[model samples]
Target chain A: GAGVSQSPRYKVAKRGQDVALRCDPISGHVSLFWYQQALGQGPEFLTYFQNEAQLDKSGLPSDRFFAERPEGSVSTLKIQRTQQEDSAVYLCASSRDGYRGEQYFGPGTRLTVT
Target chain B: AQSVTQLDSQVPVFEEAPVELRCNYSSSVSVYLFWYVQYPNQGLQLLLKYLSGSTLVKGINGFEAEFNKSQTSFHLRKPSVHISDTAEYFCAVILDDKIIFGKGTRLHILP
Candidate 1:
């Protein structure tokens, strides 16, 4: 079965530039999530979506981060004014429903702010 | 809020040797535990999960985990490991519909 997928596997951007990362969740998955992973560190939560609603965004570090899932199947995480601190791997995951279900993750997009 | 801790930053073991990766979590509410493996340049793959039922849970690639609610620990174990098992493993807990992960443990398999 096809798993979650993300695009722009690697990206390099100048400081202050804006970048958008895309994620495609598995079919019929009711839950979508985004995370950030720094080098040698565990992934930190960014946001979560249930269907088309943005349920949780507390883990998004700053106001510069914004995420949206208009149709409930695909999502985008956009960062305005890219900074050195934003350089990390952005991971996407999908699950059947809520907390108890297992999440399937995407390969992630590595963003390097240069 | 839930927080996870992976006690070891790295673990090295010879091929075919047994291994254990320690994980502990803290939460005021009931939690669901999980273990994920990430190969180089790859996304995380679910190794196993402990939601309920038996405390001993078996997962993919010959991996198993023991859930200890009293200890707030979900440690991953393998009786025998292959070279391919070398990767980053993460311990995570889900509470209030949010998933929190630990710093992760890097497994190095020596031939």
Candidate 2:
């Protein structure tokens, strides 16, 4: 694809339910990132991946949140026991490592917890 | 830890008038600054960035920002505004390989 791709542009899940959000980064990109944007707020970093390695996960709000990129091209963010506070837009971006390049963001997945 | 603050939650400007949006950041290490714009129902687009060199950096859409390390500010400015320039603007700072974003400023260009 020409740009980063995110699946399920919108998702609705009940409280306590589990959900998974997927991101397909630009091909050959070495760095991928996930962010969470609340209403009227800017995106907050969630995690980062360098190729297949999960370089950083410090921003994950809690243990309920987990992310992985097995092959380095595609990543998944899984939330166990979704809560109302988890409702937000999940954005995925990819960029090259070692240089200050612009990150390409996807349309984002709007998640709602009932 | 890194943090960015956009002092103005909203800015309203008449078309053709000049506008400025203020942003500040706090970081323990040297930083990279960036501004991103988000239109309705669209993803964010990078407007400009300040990595190093001159204090002033120009970005797309005739927008520019000045980095003031002493004051810890990177304010975005435009000489003229248009209706189409209305969007949500975000300030970001990269610190210790982590990116931190501000709450955002909503720019409303009036006719």
Candidate 3:
């Protein structure tokens, strides 16, 4: 693809349900990032992956929020026991390198937790 | 910890008029500043970035931003904006290897 791609542009999940969002970064991008954007708020960092290694997960709000990049090219963000607060636009971005590189973002998946 | 503040939630500007979007950041260590623009139903695109050297940085679409270290601000500006320029602009800061964004400012360019 020419740019980063995110799957399930919209997701509606009932409380306690589990949902998974996928992200396909640009070819050979070394850094992948996930962010959660609440309504009327800026996107907040959730986690980052350097290749297949998740180097940062400090921004995950709770234990239920999990992300993985098994092959380093495609990634998934899974939320277990979804809460209302988890309802937001989940954005995925990729960069050429880890240090000070420009990040290219995906269209994002709008998750609605009821 | 680092935080970015975009004072105005929205700004309305007439076409061909100059526009400025203010942004301020707080960080304990050296930081990198960036401006991103998001069109409707689209992902964010980098407008410009302030890394080092000159305080004033020019970007695509005739947009430019100045990094003022003394005031902890990196304000974006365009001499004349077009109707197509209407979009949500976000200011972000890099601190502790993490990028944090502000609430964002919706720029409405009127024809």
Q: For each candidate, C-alpha RMSD in Å?
A: 1.3, 1.3, 0.9
Candidate 3, residue A54: the lDDT equals 98
What is candidate 2's TM-score against the reference?
A: 0.96
Ordering by TM-score = 3, 2, 1
Tell me the interface RMSD of model 2, in angstroms: 1.4
The better candidate by TM-score, 2 or 3, is 3
Distance (Å) between predicted and true CA of B76, model 3?
A: 0.1
Q: Give lDDT tens digits, candidate 3, residues A22-108.
A: 999999999999999998999999999999999999999999999999988999999999999899999999999874789999999
Candidate 3 chain A: worst-modelled 10 consecutive residues by lDDT:
A94-103
The residue pairs found clashing in candidate 2 are none
Judged by DockQ cut-offs, the docking class of candidate 2 is medium
TM-score of candidate 1 relative to the true fold: 0.96
- Provide the DockQ value for model 1: 0.84
Clashes of each: 0, 0, 0
Question: Residue A82, candidate 1: how far off, in angstroms?
Answer: 1.1
Question: What 10-residue stretch in candidate 1 chain A is worst by lDDT?
Answer: A95-104
Local accuracy of candidate 1 as per-residue lDDT tens digits, A1-114: 888989999999999999999999999999999999999899999998999999999999999999999998999999999999999999999999766788899999999999
Clashing residue pairs for model 1: none
lDDT over C-alpha atoms for residue B79 of model 3: 97
lDDT of 3 by residue, B31-95 (tens): 99999999987999999998889999999999999998889999999999999898999999998
